[model samples]
Target: MSCKYIYSHVVRLLNESDTICIEFEDAMFGRPKSIRLLREDIVRFMEIREIGARQILVYMGHLYKELKKKDKADYFSFLDPGNIPTCPIGTDDRDLSQHIADQLEAVCRDSICLIPYNTGYHWILTIVNEDKNMIHLLNSTSNRNRDDTWKTIVTNGVKMYNASKGISKGPGFKILTGNLKQSGSVECGYCVMRYMKEIVDCDDPQLEKMFAGCIKNQYYTQCQYDEVRSEWSEFVYSYVGA
Candidate 1:
């Protein structure tokens, strides 16, 4: 988890993964001018590898934070465990374990948390709003009903936290609705990063407007998604270069 290790790993991944390299290039310098460009051509040259560079960008603290203008204590960002060796979210057959409970407690300690959530195939964000005692699901697909498992996880975690603190009464957790949502199927990760920006910017009125617009659109576009990713990628590149 050291910065040096993360920096080196990200650089290697970007250079080795062709699709991500192209995406990083596109984000840094717009699309190629040549009309002859095609997916086949990129595939032939791409150094095919697993796509975890972006995840590394997210977990390694490469993303920038403008601390001069905002309170650092308000937001807590943690990278979620999604791959092998990590236990799956609890289900009827499986109960919530101590390790997962500890993770939840850490997230809930912050006023707002930005953590990744995996749905076996796709990735999404689960935002914990400690102030409101609510868990907001910023899903890209506009599927509200899909957050039941997460809700259970948060609820159980809160209970365990209160017990550990020896508090008989405490604020309970609830799922927040009607917040900003992603527009595309694959844009959830991007939306999560953007949410991190919104939390730090502290522009209440503008944030409200942004959420209202997303609610009206029912979903945003890949363009918006790419824009957020571009910002984060820039931060990652700068950190690596530095």
Candidate 2:
């Protein structure tokens, strides 16, 4: 009957089956907002496996909505990672470019945007502060040079958004690397998720300092990863019911 017990039960069911475990209306990308996750998708959080796009999208979607409900996301926006392709090709490239532009235009000029970007091999957190025109890349793997592709994708999107709004060209967003904890091979996705949670939990004034000073080059403890796993399981269980 307790929440912890229910979360454990749901996680057990997720590991045991691969059927659709939960469905929710995700309006993160506007129309066609429905999202369905299979048991395997949810189980990734319950295990030590590399999480896929589904897990990132679903978990962030939940966080975004919760922040909105509490009116705590006024100065920030969370983008759906699915809309931004890792290696966009041909017409897909053009479509995704426009999608990013549209999503950017919806947020205010001086606000921050939290983007969860996945390189084919790992997930990294990209924070765009439009006010300062800076892009902060948080890579848990200590590979600072790994964000070149993401820089290209977002730079193009920002240009397209500016052009559509008839704004003059300016020097684009400056990219900087944050000194975040180094993650293991399979922990990148969870690390990104934890980054977002902590970032949003900070007050507006402390946002810059938290990334700049508080979190140094340290690794997440087992208890920290377990905390994320527990939160993720509870989030899924809310939709799955008893």
Candidate 3:
């Protein structure tokens, strides 16, 4: 594929059909620090959608660094088919995330779900019909397999932030793990658009400027595109089957 790009007016695809969707902004460089909250967001989004059982978060842009041959894979973080993904560790974190993502893939197998890499940023594929218990299945073996404990599968959102922007922009993508952001959180995307209308968003200008100055890549656009395609298919399938 030539890698299609998104147009200007893209929006989250939300509606009737088979799935629920969620989005997370990156810190320019992908980071896994938001794992707990990202999980919370997924869990909360599913519960609110009343589809907790079926939904799952897809952590994109997992940066696993290359490890030395002497590096022992003894740690839970180390066992990752990917790596722990330090700004230096991401290559290793990549291997770790893939393993977890695969387990997640296997857990949701036969059911409908998608885990894709776009800009190395995190995106989730949630199936509305599935239940919270189903979501639990992916992690069921974690406690048992302590050595290979599966945490959430986080990949890179996009390298656009890291490659194109200067190093000072940093290695992580902007995290909007909540309705609001931390005082110093990098601002970008809808958050900035919302702030521009001056609609009581937040007083912090730091985030607003960050979001305002950020650039988006084809991968994030692709994720949204695929979501729309999936939703449209489900919608048409509903009427056509009738």
For model 2, the superposed segments whose C-alpha errors exceed 4 Å read 1-27, 88-96, 106-110, 130-132, 174-176, 205-208, 213-217
| TM-scores, all models, native as reference | 0.59, 0.79, 0.19
Model 3 agreement with the true structure over 1-242: per-residue lDDT tens digits: 11111111111232223232322223211333222222333323322222111122221211111111223111101111122232221133555445444443333322222222111222111111121122111110112232122222232211221232232232221221222221221212212212222211223323324334323221123334334334323322232212
Can you tell me which runs of candidate 1 are displaced by over 4 Å?
Answer: 1-64, 67-97, 104-110, 170-177, 203-216, 239-242
The per-model lDDT (C-alpha) reads: 0.45, 0.66, 0.24
Worst 10 residues of 2 by lDDT: 170-179
Candidate 3 whole-model C-alpha lDDT, 0 to 1: 0.24
Q: Write the per-residue lDDT of candidate 2 for residues 1-242, one digit (tens) a residue.
A: 23356446656655544444444443444445545677666555566688877787767766766778788756667777776667632223555556777888765455678888887778888787755345677778756464665676666776677777676673254433444564567888888888888877666634456656444557888777776666666666566642
Q: Of the pair 2 and 3, which is ahead by lDDT? A: 2
Task: Report lDDT (Cα) of residue 229, candidate 1.
Answer: 47
lDDT for 221 (candidate 1): 58
Candidate closer to the true structure by TM-score (higher is better), 1 or 3: 1
Candidate 1 on 72-136: residue-level lDDT in tens?
53344443443212234456212443444465554444345555655555555555555434455
Winner on lDDT (1 vs 3): 1
